[model samples]
Target: MVVDLQARLRDALAGSDVDELVELGCDLADAGRQEQALACFQRAVDLGQDWIWFNVANTLRELDRPTEAVTAYQRAIAAGQSDAWLNLAHVLDSLGDLAGAMEAYRAAGQAGGQPEGHVQLAHLLHQQGEPQRAQAALAPALQRGYLPAVALAARWRWENTRESADPVLEQQLRAGAGVDGSARADLAELLIATGRREQAREQLQLGAKLGQRECWLPLGNLLAGDDLSAEPGQEQEVDGAEVDKAGAEEAYRAGIAAGDEWCHHNLALLLLQRGDVRAAEEHLLAGAAAGDELAQLAWQDLHQQD
Candidate 1:
């Protein structure tokens, strides 16, 4: 129906206005008609509108043609659309053009790009062995109240300030907990490392209540009596007291709803232990789709008979 309406509009108006064409392109894109969307965007581009170039680049990227996306993005930049540079940098990174990606990221920052672009630029700089520059890049994001940057800056400061689990570190972590979910998760981890299982459980429960979904996995495991060992075959110093499975299931379901991929894997294991193979398989497939390695392995094993 959208395609037919687009055809009627094109015939009625003779496709003069670039905005109308772009709107139609967006509608087609939303409807998953990529080929038609691409055509509309290209027609707008041929009519020499700068902003339409971004749409063309996005469609190219969605079609898995990142090379063409790079060209379109560059053209968009030339046509006074500097905001497309960050997306161009992402495509460049995927194609292993790190030097180009770094340059584009810097250009994006100069163009008043989003804080996330600065975060990615800092990460790339860090990976390239430029720690000081990476820290410098993160400064702007921290000032802008980017939570991940705030958490990362807190951690870096903590690393430089203390060598072990000290009262100061605990205080700082707790202070940052209200600002970053990672801070809460880190506090829980520090408690666990110090053999404070009861404190860790409380911290994790608080973290979950504060919307830290990743906390649920550990919370669920703590409820289910599973040892949070560093590795398989390692002895855990935790007490062997088990809580109710009902609570564990509740935590796992909360994590799954909050988009934690590994929660599906953990919940599937719990379901399987309770002899619900069909339900377990359903969750295993969901986790696999979300890129959980353990879930992929479990899914392969479960389907080996088929």
Candidate 2:
């Protein structure tokens, strides 16, 4: 994102008021010139433009400086920028200040943010082991038939109950699968769970071609015959099934290349089972460093054996 500011743009900025500077900052931010945008925003703020602290916070967040953004957001809130409360909550959540984020989210609603704030709060609550409260938080969005909220509610309920899929939710999920790699992975997983292994494989293969990272894990699992144990001389061999060990390895490697850390666990398992302990340990270490729980557990077990 190399952006060269034109002479005309520079001339415009030299004569702009605080409002114009904020507008220019927004435009620059939108165009991926976040550093330039920050400069514009900071310049405006320095000239007694106290009300534009929210703009300053947004630019800081875009720069991936969340701590600075938090301060600017608080200043914005103090200056009566109500929307800053919602934004500040997002930053706090990113910083693992969940309790603070919860408070900020409540304040956002009271001080007036979008109705979608409920959905955001609900997701956070669910993440923090308060599923009941999370469901309660979703009530407002559910009443309005917000799609993101509805889909999330369905997914959470599915995780708990494993009940038959509703037609409406299935349709929504399929639509999501068309656009999102994780959704492709989720849809393929659902198919496999319902005894449609071939369909899952086909869907995952198609999504892999679409550059979807998550699809690769399930695709590899399918190739490896869904965790079927290897025979004394053969892999996942049961009822004449031939586990495509090479194919599975390729899929796992592809997934890793595509930034899917979870693939390391399964690949490590495969290698470990095949007596390639060194390679498996390398992957386990990498996955654990990437914060993958399964890989972490496997790595711990390996250490305990030592």
For all predictions, the C-alpha RMSD in Å is: 6.3, 3.9
Residue pairs with backbone overlap in model 2: none
In model 1, what are the clashing residue pairs, if there are any?
Answer: none
Candidate 2 local lDDT, 1-306, one digit each (tens): 233454424754686577777877787888888887888888887887877889999989988999999999999888889888889999999999988998888777557555567778887888889999999988776777666666667667556765535555556556656556666666676776776777778889999999877789889988988873464356355235677888999999999999999899999988987788899999999999999988999988977998
C-alpha local distance difference test of each model: 0.79, 0.79
Q: Ten residues in a row with the worst lDDT in model 1?
A: 227-236
- What is the alpha-carbon RMSD of candidate 1 to the true structure? 6.3
Model 2: lowest-lDDT 10 consecutive positions: 1-10
Off by over 4 Å in 2: 1-14, 18-20, 26-35, 46-51, 75-83, 106-116, 165-172, 175-184, 205-212, 231-242, 273-275, 296-306
Model 1 global lDDT (CA atoms, 0 to 1) = 0.79
Q: What is the lDDT of residue 218 in candidate 1?
A: 81
